[model samples]
Target: MTKEENLEKMRHSTSHVMAEAVQSLFTGVRFGIGPAIEDGFYYDFELARPLTPEDLPAIENKIREIVDADYPFIREEVDKEEARQLFADQPYKLELIDEFPDNRVTIYKQGSFADLCRGPHVASTSEIKAFKLTHIAGAYWRGDERSPMLQRIYGVAFDSEAELEGYLARQAEAMKRDHRKLGKELDIFSIHEEIGPGLVCWHPRGALIRQIIEDFWKAEHIKRGYDIVYTPHIAKLALWKTSGHWDFYRDYLYSPIEVEGQEYILRPMNCLGHILIYNSQLRSYRDLPLRYAELGTVYRYERTGVLHGMARVRGFTQDDAHIFCRPDQIEAEVAGVLKLAQLMMSTFGFNDYELLLSTRPERYVGSIQMWDEATDSLATVLEKLELPYDLDPGEGVFYGPKIDIKLRDALGHAWQGPTIQVDFNLPERFDVCYIGDDGAEHPVVMIHRTVLGSMERFVACLTEHYGGVFPVWLSPLQVVIIPIADRHVDYAQQIKNELEEEAIRSRVDERAERMSWKIREAQLQKIPYMLIVGDKEVESSNVSLRLRSGEDVGMRSLLQVKSLIKAVIEARAQTALEGESI
Candidate 1:
């Protein structure tokens, strides 16, 4: 078996053993679904009482004891009636059996436990070499809020001790770099119960960083022949119906709002608005490939339990753009978008990334011919650019085929960054057309793309990727001036003024705190540079610079420092002034 398959088997089997251990310890326990997750496995249980961490050790011991017995996993296929009779005492299992359409059912029995499951388990419990029970939580059955909440036990397993150790080390580092903790510590953003869950309120510093990012994004799009546009946050619900969003994507959409007796929707996507703009006027072939860009804010209904800090929020601003082009222009437009995505990701210091081409899913719009044509266009562009990519079958959106780019961060964890989708269904649904060379109206192909995905999630990723130590170009406050005493406050202000005149974002720490304390605070804030204007530096008309890394560069003239900072900003360097060439 492949390594991934083996790992899945090990994890699944470990979860079975854990369930058996839980049943052995707790009386009147009922089993729920248990499956292997990304790096681990979790099983849900309905017990008479809640579990505590103190109970984990005892349960772990029971699991080890069962593993020592090395009982073989025996699979049995029985009729639906027989399965239901066997699991009559287990209500959850009976419910699952009732849902099955066929008469045949599969069950696996090992040691003193039996579960209704599809079997691909390891040969025996002894195959689980290394395992650790991580934590416990309460999860709703089938992820539905109305269902009963079951106690969930999470654990991790690996084929070897060395693999387990490596995974644990990475987990520790990930905890230290957790974005939610860093976001609060750095005062970047916050979510309050009063404001409703999954809604972010960006603080002053966070807003400043977002403004800088948006400014850079707009400038780049303008330079690349995209016209910036703005659209409202709500529109008539009929517009969504026409775009096929209401029918296919209603789960993520909020309830309709009534205005003047008509139903309106909070915009869940920006593509429909961009398409409306294109349809505003009749177009010729010459006007084809019109690219419209917007940093549009959208709202979606996400379950509260799944809502994370900023990474998974209910409301966010998408760096969204759409292109309406003729059939022949499709390939070139896709190629151009690929180049733009590469440029944007590399600028953020994400050099290692993977591209995936997702094809049509089972429930999709448009004809098979159109789907094949659109899929071929995307494939042709990837080949033209000589970019390596993997095909994700049956993973595309209902409306189109897409190319998804996932960027690997410093911790080697991948985050979704960019996407390019060729949509034929929307054009057909809206009857979007342009005049062809033959003096006939023909449907125009549409492409939806995003570079940064969303501002909130991107900032979250950036915060964790750099551990809140942003580079000079992206830092909300580029420099902080520290005055040694009250006498030197005037000199510090003078330096701040000079830096501000050069359009640099600088702050003067004129608080009553000591100079050392101020320096430490600035360092903790992760400002790129701390400029100290003591008497000695004031006499020589210079400022002593200290980097966030604690590197001291002594006594540089104001002009020299300003020039260095400006050079770095202009080049969009990802590092500060360490004498490295831009």
Candidate 2:
């Protein structure tokens, strides 16, 4: 077998050993499916009680014993009746057996522990090595909420111990770069039980960063011929019903609010509002490709288990836009949006990304012909742009086929960055039409897109990508003035006033602390530059510069320093003092 194939079998076999250990330790522990997933393995069980981290070491010890025994994994085929009797006590396994229509069933046995499974495991328990159980979490059986919640044990196994060590080291770095930890330490954003889970309250620093992003997004959209628009957060429920969101996305929709005997709901999307605007006026082919953009906030009822910091939130603003164009203009409109997406993503220092062309799903609203045409248009744009992409079958939404781009950061983490979808269903459903030169009404093609996705998720990606050391343009406090002593306070304040007039975010460290302490505090805050003012520097009309990385940049005139900082900010450079030794 190839190396990857062997590793897969080893991981699978390790999961069986884990199951055997669990069965011996816990009496009446019903088992669920255990599968080798990407980078690791997981097994679900309805145990007598909750499993904890403290329980993992004991399980690992039992697994070691099983491995030391060198038990061969034996595959056996049995009659359906025999399989039923074998797993009669294990209802989860029996449920699997009942789903198969065949007369025979296959089972894999390692030592005395037999499980109903299809065979593709290592030869024996001894073949498994370099395995460690990581952590535990609750999972619903088959991912159905109505089903019983099961305790899931997760573990990692590699072909060698060295590989395992490397993976764990990378995981440690990932933990250090975790957005939730940095968000708290930097006072970026916070979630409270009173405000509910999956909802974020942006602090001053985070909001300032968000404002900078918003300003850039709006400016770019306007430059691309998009007219900014706004829509209410809550609308009458009947509107969603007409847009097909009520029938299709009801699960993610919140409960209705009754205002004066009318049912209203928090909008889960901004498409319907844009559609309403398109229908408000009589359009013409001459107005083809009318682009409307909005930084609209919407709400979704996300499960509590899935919420993490700003990455996944209940209320977030999407940098959403819709294009109403004729069928002939589809390619040009898509190309324009894709170009804009590329610019926005690259400006944020994301150069590594993957594109996916997602085709129609099983349950869809548009006719197959329209779906084919829309898919072809997106593919044609990709070809024209000389961009390669992978095909994801049956993953598109019920309304359209989309191009999804995932951005990879320096840490090799992928973030959902940009997307463009061609929708024919909404236009047809809403009867959104434009009068053509033939003097007749025809359905206008609708394009939905977001270059940077939601504000919350984008900020989370930025936080992790740079490890909270944001670029000069995106930094909340660009420069901090640190006065050496009480005598330098006035001069420092004057410098701060000058920088503020230059539109550079600056602050004065007025605390009665040592200059070193103040400079250390600024560095801890990840401020881009620390300007030190003392008697000598004040007398010379200069400031000592210190980088957050703790480099002394020597003393320089405030005029020259401000010019360098302003140039970096204006160019949206990825790093401050680009090409400088510091």
- Using all chains and alpha carbons, the TM-scores for the candidates as numbered come to 0.85, 0.91
Model 2 lDDT tens row, 1-582: 898888888888888899999999999989999989777799999988889899999999999999999999999999889998999899999899989989798999998799988869988999988989999999999999999899999999998899999999988887777778889988999999998888899999999999999999999999989999998899999988988899998989999999999999999999888889989999989988899999999999988777768988899999999999999999999999999998988898777779999999999987899999999999999999999999999989899999999865435667677889988789988999999999999999999999998999889988888888899999999999999999899999999999999999999998899999998888888899999999989999999998887888999999999998999999988878887432
* Candidate 1 C-alpha lDDT tens digits along 255-337: 99998999999999998888888999999999988999999999999877777778889999999999999989989999998
- Model 2's number of clashes is 0
Q: What is model 1's C-alpha RMSD? A: 4.1
Please list the C-alpha lDDT of all candidates, in the order they appear: 0.89, 0.90
Q: What is the lDDT of residue 569 in candidate 2?
A: 93
RMSD to native for every prediction?
4.1, 2.9
Residue 174 error, candidate 1, Å: 2.2
